[model samples]
Target: MVNSFISGLAGPLKPDLEMMAICKVSIPGLKTGKEQTSEVKRGRDPIFNQEFFFDHVTIEDLDTKNVSITAFHHGGAKLGKDLLIGEAVVPLREIRELNAKKEVKVIEEIKQAIPK
Candidate 1:
């Protein structure tokens, strides 16, 4: 996964489709600038997100449990726009770490990280 992120971010994608997925994700720049995609595909439709964005800051840490979905977003053409954050959350069916001492520990860690 790290390799995929590094390679896709560092150089051109070779698999074409993956490259297209990487290309589909963009950041703030000239033309059609897009916020970097912190998307993490899981075993569901809504999908798991790693980055969370607020109006002014970006939450890059992957916190898939409490990730929120913006139903309607405004701003943008007025005074810039809100942070392009991903909603990180831990789905009910998420896989647990084999070496996790306790599942609550990881969840607690994630909860502590999510912004208020």
Candidate 2:
């Protein structure tokens, strides 16, 4: 099984911006898994005490899968589109090791997506 938890965001986020967090599990040879939090409006610090789960993950999949958590601004200066604020990627193998220690609070710095 795979699990994702989004706690909150803190930084220079615009106060009037509406935002949400998305959690996606990418497993090789499988469908992309996705889950999202509800919109938090008008706040620099958005709290999303949300958890997502994928039920069919096998032990072998841990070494080859990754979980991506992305934050997005909803309908702001970009007009009708959701703009990517930042994102973090974690390998499932690392998560499994942390889970064994019972300290799975893997903190990662969010990074801007490279222009493509």
Candidate 3:
């Protein structure tokens, strides 16, 4: 699950607070898998209670795989563009270590993505 919070952000807050959470899994020399949660309504803090899974992920692949969770402001039809708020990346190895210690949850601070 991905929880997005962008309080204290610069600039005026957009009227439409709809937001989406995306999860992307990447492995070297393999096709990437992406999953996204339905848009949520929250001015600055959106909690996405969801799960994403990638099939055929072998133990060997964990060494070279990473998971990226991203949050985007879903501009409605009027804007026609989704704005990226922030994202966090986690290596599979770190996740493995967490699991070994019976720790299944991790909180990674989202690093703001520079707007294009």
After superposition, candidate 3 runs with Cα above 4 Å error: 1-32, 96-116
Ranked candidates (TM-score, high to low): 2, 3, 1
Candidates in order, TM-scores: namely 0.18, 0.58, 0.55
lDDT of every model, 2 decimals: 0.28, 0.54, 0.48
Report the lDDT of model 2 for residue 72.
73
Score candidate 2 by lDDT.
0.54
Report model 1's TM-score to 2 decimal places. 0.18
lDDT of 2 by residue, 59-109 (tens): 445567777667776755656777676678878787654355332332221
Ranking by lDDT: 2, 3, 1
Tens digit of lDDT per residue, candidate 1, span 44-105? 12222332222221122222222222211122465354433222223222323312435346
- lDDT of candidate 1 at residue 78, scale 0 to 100: 57
Instruction: Give stretches of model 1 more than 4 Å off.
Output: 1-79, 83-99, 103-116
Supply the TM-score for candidate 3. 0.55
How good is model 2 by TM-score?
Answer: 0.58
C-alpha root-mean-square deviation, each candidate:
14.2, 11.5, 11.6
**Candidate 3's C-alpha lDDT?**
0.48
